[model samples]
Target: MESSSALALSQLPYYIYPTIPNTNKNYPFWPAGKRRSSQLPTRLHCNKMFVPGFGEASPEAKAAKNLHNFFTYIAVKIVAAQLESYNPEAYEELMEFVGRHPLNDGDKFCATMFRESSRHKNLALRIMEVRSSYCQNDFEWDNLKSLAFKMVTESNTRLMRDYISETSRAETEK
Candidate 1:
């Protein structure tokens, strides 16, 4: 007697995404030797977890939660696929850890920013605005610099053309 939406949702893969392992702490909730465990209640609380929106939330809330989780999984999968074209190793690692794992929205944003160079600083900065919460300290600084270099040096994007020209002029003056 479930609604069509409910049926659709049931057909989609559902899993409690695991958080990436941190250097400092151990996650005790995922019982040893288990491939999947129920999602923990609060990301901060390792001990407390239950089926999301099962008993405590209203039907509307449950729908919303399901939608959010579904979309997050899709988005991460898309980004990981994009990484595969540019950096296969990074793509593999991201997929292995983040594809089915739980991460805050900020962490997802950071994952996309792992690119070697982007033509869009404004976009990158916009994503970075959320960086305060979930950046894992995993990005390579060299890649970031290379990204900036491409943005400025490439003919396509004009974000730093004037600045680069001015700097070159000053260097020549010296």
Candidate 2:
């Protein structure tokens, strides 16, 4: 695996460009036996891997880890709520069936019919409720608020605005 700089060193057709290595020629400046350059290119790729936006060394890795934790927390909350609110035998049977099959696993779990519905806030809160096991005295919805903000800002802000205008126009026609 040659570095781009190393490959570049091979491309000098004329007297090597001063920026790249060109020891192929028998330059008299070298000792009678020296074959290659003594220096190596410094490796610092800046386009793709960047410092984290919030002062993190590995921004992308941290975001990925946080998202993983958040998703796992939500999944556990969903399962626990389903178990607490339903019959364990039914949930177990459903897990067993899905365990034996290729599937989406969460939405298609069947026994969690209501939890899989369209009420995003309710679903998230219920998951929080299950995970926190608290009643009425603060369920930590704020923990997910930042994630929700990011999802809205990054994923759907423009689409949602356009959809709202489209829906308004369609409603006016009706």
Candidate 3:
């Protein structure tokens, strides 16, 4: 008298049936005999992750880094300006060298500057080294170099006149 669909439905697994709500006082979801452990496992050590040399530096270290970066920047500007004004061919050669080497950071810039045996490059490197014993800051070497290059190359004589007057005034004051 049972239909085929009814038989098939009855043959399905027990878990397929929806859970019935338990209304008994002694038993909750679990059966009467079984009980889960109440206490959780204790952690033996801290869960915090650490990385070496990735933490903040001391105030003195930070100041030294800033000073180094400042001097490097000034040296780069001075070199570019001098080359642009005094020797156009040497300035072109320097730009070509920079393009080839792609100085991305301070250390790379210093190394490349020294590697090339040019008077301007040597002077610049000497200036930077005398200012700072180490080069750690990953300053924008390419952009700064190009900016200084363009500033001196594109500027009119008026700026130079103003700079001369300012220097003379400072000399008088001193």
Candidate 4:
């Protein structure tokens, strides 16, 4: 049998050296007689392990999580509205995929089937209706409104100017 002590330490670069017995605290791998003024060169594994963006600590991951949460809430509302029962098996399959996959994957999956036929179009509209209900109730459409305001203010086009005037008049009347 090969003894562990016979193995060279350098071969296992990732081995935590501090765990070894009788290794004094002066340095991780310092020889007992070493008395140099300079410290031993420390090996720092600074490279972080690659984490997938779908569920990692990144901002994109956070946004994807938020989107998935919102999608789940919308789906629950759709199910409550009896729309889910109309196509029980399809709804279950979609929910299963949504639960397991990332938001971008879900979007790609939906887009691929969203316009395949009239039935798909109708289903897409129903999903949109569910999302609209959530947006209306949660007051979560502010970003879109802000974007529209930005476009209206920045554009010097005649149509935009007309829209600005019409909105301003409507606001005054209200």
Best by lDDT: 3
> How would you encode candidate 3's per-residue C-alpha lDDT over 1-174 as one tens digit per residue?
222223243234457643323343445665544444432222224333333453587555765566566666665655567779988887786667657764435566677677677764665565575445423344466776799778887685668888999999999998
lDDT of 1 by residue, 1-174 (tens): 222223333233346443523322355674555433342222232333334545778565875565444445455555556667987875666555555545555445455545524533333343344332223344355786798678767755564777789899999999
31 Cα displacement, candidate 1 (Å): 74
Specify the poorest-scoring 10-residue window by lDDT in model 2. 102-111
Residue 64 in candidate 4, Cα distance off native in Å: 5.9
RMSD of 3: 23.8
Better of 2 and 3 by lDDT: 3
Clash total of candidate 2: 0
Instruction: Give the Cα error of residue 83 in candidate 4, in Å.
Output: 2.3
lDDT of 1 at 16: 40
Minimal lDDT window, size 10, model 1? 39-48
Report lDDT (Cα) of residue 15, candidate 1. 66
Instruction: For each candidate in the order shown, give its overall lDDT on alpha carbons.
Output: 0.50, 0.51, 0.58, 0.56
Higher-scoring candidate on lDDT, 1 or 2: 2
Better of 1 and 4 by lDDT: 4
Q: Is candidate 2 or candidate 4 better by lDDT?
A: 4
The prediction achieving the highest TM-score against the true structure is: 3
| Tens-digit lDDT string for candidate 2 (121-161) | 34444444453453233345576678778888977878988
Shift in Å, residue 104, candidate 2: 26
